[model samples]
Target: MTALQAATRETFWTIGPVGKAAFYWLAAVAVLAFGYGVYARFAAYARGREDPRDRLSNLPGRVVSATRTVLSNENQFDGDLYAGVMHTFVLWGFLVLLVATTILGIDIDVYRPLAGESFWVGDFYLVYQFAVDAFGLLFVVGVGMAMFRRYRERDGRLWGKHTSLEDDAFVWTLFLLGVGGFVLQAIGIVGQPARADEAVSFVGMAMAAGFEAAGLTTAGAEAIYGVVWWSHSLLAFAFIAWIPYAKPFHMISSFANVVARDETAGARLPNVPADLDHTNAESLDDFTWKELMDGDACTKCGRCTDACPADTVGRNLDPRDVILDLKAYRESVVDDPVAGRRDSGVATDGGVDGSATVSDGGTVPIVADEGGVIASESMESCMSCMACMDACPVDIEHLTSFTRMNRQLVDEGAVDSNLQDVFQDVMTKGNTFGESQSKRGDWADDLEFEVDDARETEVEYLWYVGDYPSFDDRNKKVARSLARLFEEADVEFGILFDDEKNDGNDVRRIGEEFLYLELAGHHVETFADCEFETIVCTDPHSYNTMRNEYPEVDFAEFADDPMMPFDREEPWNADGETDVLHWTQVVEELVDDGRLGLSGNELDYTVTYHDPCHLGRYNDEYEAPRELIRATGADLHEMPRSRSDSFCCGGGGGGLWAEHDEEVKPSEERLREALEDTDAGDGIEKFVVACPMCTTMFEDGRKTGGFEEDVEIVDVAELLIEAMEAGS
Candidate 1:
């Protein structure tokens, strides 16, 4: 054969024609199997209800965003550092190896066949050779770390009831592939007469030298290389086919999940039909296809569960279990409807235990004894803090799943007594605390400034004093502070006073979807009568709900009642549209514009700010509250878990009213964490909060945890007002 023909020969050196043929055949089978597995997964996903998750119009942008997230590894690093490093190495190694394989395939299949010579031959080939070997080593190292985590560390996050042998097999498969590839290359290079220079593949060269030192002959090395090469190739094929069947299905589903993520990052309660029937998720079929895919997309990283406040307090709810349980239920029912059904009085062992089949071949009950896929205790424990969703690297919306399940539980009247009372109070009295609507405006009665009722006067800003601020005695102080700030800024704002209703942010999260809609619709109706350019909410919950959810509620209700005042046709916050602003955000703007002046003594009181779930994660307004606090002339101290990682005060999702048996509450845990360095010279003496719920929870925590002597919990407005008073 000509020199060019020799150069263009198959890339493998020792593999005989039969071995190549066998490899090609196995590869083809793997591809076919992979295709079938993927098809089956999609078919399972198809069993779910329709979800408008795809943004086809902005497909290119979505792809770019997905690619950026994957390549940047931003989500992985946002939580645990050790896991992030391990994941980064594994991800980059796999990506590099995959790219190298593709290039090699192109060279062997197209370039060599057409041009009679491989394109990657000289220095570039050496670099390519080095790069592949280096990345293969990296892959092995990453796999080793993962193995350590699984075997030695045994992190509960990765290994638990949900984990199976498939998890181990997935990691082992990659490890074997990486180690086998390196060993095969080493033996091949050593066996070849023409391959003298070994440094180009440094890792392979070291292994080759070790083999040579062990007195292995060229023929023996060739035999070993032939066996190892095929072994590596076979494992690769097996892994490819196994991608869809096992826990690693996340490898395929994660991309789709990220690209198809909800447009808004905030927890969105799925809109239920106004009709009573089919209000919330009752079965697998009730969930949106995207929600079902969320089960498939989970990487089992445990970040969500770790960030969960309920889980932190040893509550029945585990965010990870919620997704996995739903996924398992969905998968079980995909092939056999009877597999996931709970027939009334049909006799069940209450779980996946016995031969209690209902004649349709199903051993597991869909809504096992633990209430449905999740126990009622677990469902009730959620604070709707969005911590779990924010911590998830794969973009799993645990809040959406929780809310959907909540809807079902509520519709079935399976809620706890406290929640039942809350529902009744909000529905009947228009507030969560069971206070009369007439008392909502009573907080404003003592303020020297005349607070205009929006119903009677036109105003630029309609100040929404949510439940706690309107009714709770402690929070009423915060309400008055904000009113004073508004007056000082000369902002033309009015309150809805007795006419206002609950914003229903927590109500929606609590699973009372219809009630939340009714409340939101009522507020929208109230806004129609009041001439206002903006709605400023003192409570973050109200701010989040008013800004993000109320518009949708208005639109949905407008269809039934055409006389609704807010123009349904206009875009949210468009021309002639009312803008929604959180109190801290507006106050920060005023301070920035030199309209609201405050004097500060940074040395007098060093403070730390606790981010409310609704304000920080739901609305992404971390900086504004801090900006306001800093503007108050106080030295800002930070807790370790602040901003996106902020721990919940345990009062969100109506958790404030709910009773807990735990010795240490999630709020108490946070209080202890906040008091970590109080003995230091610049220690935090006061805990600053922007959300009313946060203010209430932390204050109670200070008392319950015996932390009052060390740190005082105060609202951001109160602190600012104190500074303003001192300046005056």
Candidate 2:
């Protein structure tokens, strides 16, 4: 076939010469405008304080992760199927259209000039036309669904009084741009002379037929085509230019945020560099650049807020609002960090000024409640349960800013009376309750076999009985039960007696990093004198902090770090360097090996397991407790929100000590969930918990929940011990 005939075989843009040139001009202006917005957003981020997160050390791995996140959208889909599908279609549709546009640009500017004919023709061109047209229609459908959810149906998750005008504009821009493109295509199909052959796009053909059925003539179609084509082109270019200025800026920022996400576990908070008594983030300049960038990446999806226990239980803490307000505050401030340093009469050495205190002097409130970034009351309301971080698709660390701000609050001596008491107790007595250190091992007094003191004798497992299990009366029973199980399994475990103190898990979460460091350092000193192979704890909080967070602490200088039978390179295995096991894991291991002998007992109660936040989300240890429950011969029933999605018992992050409004406490809310009909529509009789905090919170919740002796909360170890004794 001739080159001209081949180019003409499959139809192309019928917008004529003048209109085509005008469209190109609009696209050029759109490109420049989009660039300007991007540059401005990045420049604002650059003004944020220094954070060492800029290294980009693992470039290849980060790129792979970013690409996977962009392509999958799995995080969003995993949470809400409807939202996920809609977002995926819109994202992939936009990506496909972008590719098509690039090809078209090449065909028109390079291929046509070089070969005297466009590259897209025949069967290939037909497939290209069909795919682009189909994806465009899909994009419109997705946008329409989103528009309905945003405006008409008003899904509570998407719409709120706090929803911004920029958000509305973002959705409307894409919705209109999509609708206009489809209408323009329909008009083009009808106005073309080869309408019969060019009606390859079924969607465009159907739309054109509808237009024709309404008494549309060829002349009318042609005139309408020109106007619709121009409108669609203008809308496309304008939407592109408006992207960085709208909520849609997340398209760019979310990708960067994912690439820049901290690779540590979700619960690991960065160590504060400055002296705790001296400084913390008191302004936008005090926040790390990456933290400031997180504000730009937020899509205002409300997933984090919806999952937040504090928010769910009627606390003033909303993760989405906290991040959004921070971004807004940053934007409201000057772009240049030192722009008016001398002019405003603020010392360049960083000290307090009127209304705006410099970060160095620690006088300014970091993430000030008065400035509306995050309210001080809201900060207290947080449980540090990690639900917000788990729910966030864009990887916004809501706790980072809150924790830093909280550190400042602590440094300024502006804590609540209850927290003050708890902090003082931890400092003075090495526990939150201010109990005597000598009584730490009193819980195991009833056990038939003796638990060796690690300081006096070598043992296999050094049991780190956390604050609750060691001091609280109810949790002390759990500790005794666990000790009996260890005796039954013939495990050589010992405690530090009066020497063991709090492991500083909750202390660290409460934003007292230096105090935690001191406590942890003391433990390192104690461990150096003891000869033990593994460390086991009854509390998930201690297990998580010791296993994950403690390694970051340098203990090499502390008496050459007492030699271990295991290697550090292979962590937590039977012969691994430093093994730290939760008691549930130890019990499960004992059961699995036929050592505890649970095969003889039959636990008849219909029970459900409550996953502690530290165990399930922080350390990903959900199955061990359940497995141990099954070994007890109990008919295990699962809660609707079990495992990683488990509801907090309201005791993590110092919530055990912090006073909360009784009417809206997270523990009561979770207890109500436990009392509700199970997923199988059967009521659970007993609530089995793994962590000490879970046990304490639920025990209190049982008293407050007003249940008629229908449900009882017990520790998993307690249940196991009961089974073991019954079997014996």
Give the top-scoring candidate (TM-score). 1
TM-score of 2: 0.91
Model 1, residue 644: distance off in Å is: 0.4
Instruction: Please give the lDDT score for candidate 1.
Output: 0.78
User: In candidate 1, what are the lDDT values of residues 159-178, reduced to their tens digit?
Assistant: 66787788888888888888
For model 2, give the 10-residue run with minimal summed lDDT. 564-573
Top lDDT hit: 1
lDDT of 2 by residue, 1-728 (tens): 74323432323355787876787788899999999999988887777667644536688899898889878988888669988888888988788888988887888889889999766876667677788888887888888777877786666767554586888788888888777767777777777656546545778778888988987767788777666767777888888898888787899999988888875534667666533234665555667778888888988888988898887888767777777766655554454454322233333222111223234322223344453345677778888888888888888877777787777777767777888888888888988879999888888887777789999999999999988888999988988888888888889989998887888888777778767766776776677788988899888988887887776654333323343211133112223376888888877878989998779346887888889999988888888998988888888878778787888999877788888764566777777777674763336778889988888888787777675376888888889888877787
Candidate 1 regions with alpha-carbon error over 4 angstroms: 1-10, 52-57, 275-279, 337-371, 554-576, 677-682
Question: Could you tell me which residue pairs clash in candidate 1?
Answer: none
Error of 2 at 657 (Å): 0.8
Model 2 CA deviation exceeding 4 Å by range: 1-20, 52-55, 153-155, 274-278, 334-365, 368-372, 554-576, 680-682
**What TM-score does candidate 1 reach?**
0.93
Q: Which ten residues in a row have the lowest lDDT in candidate 1?
A: 348-357
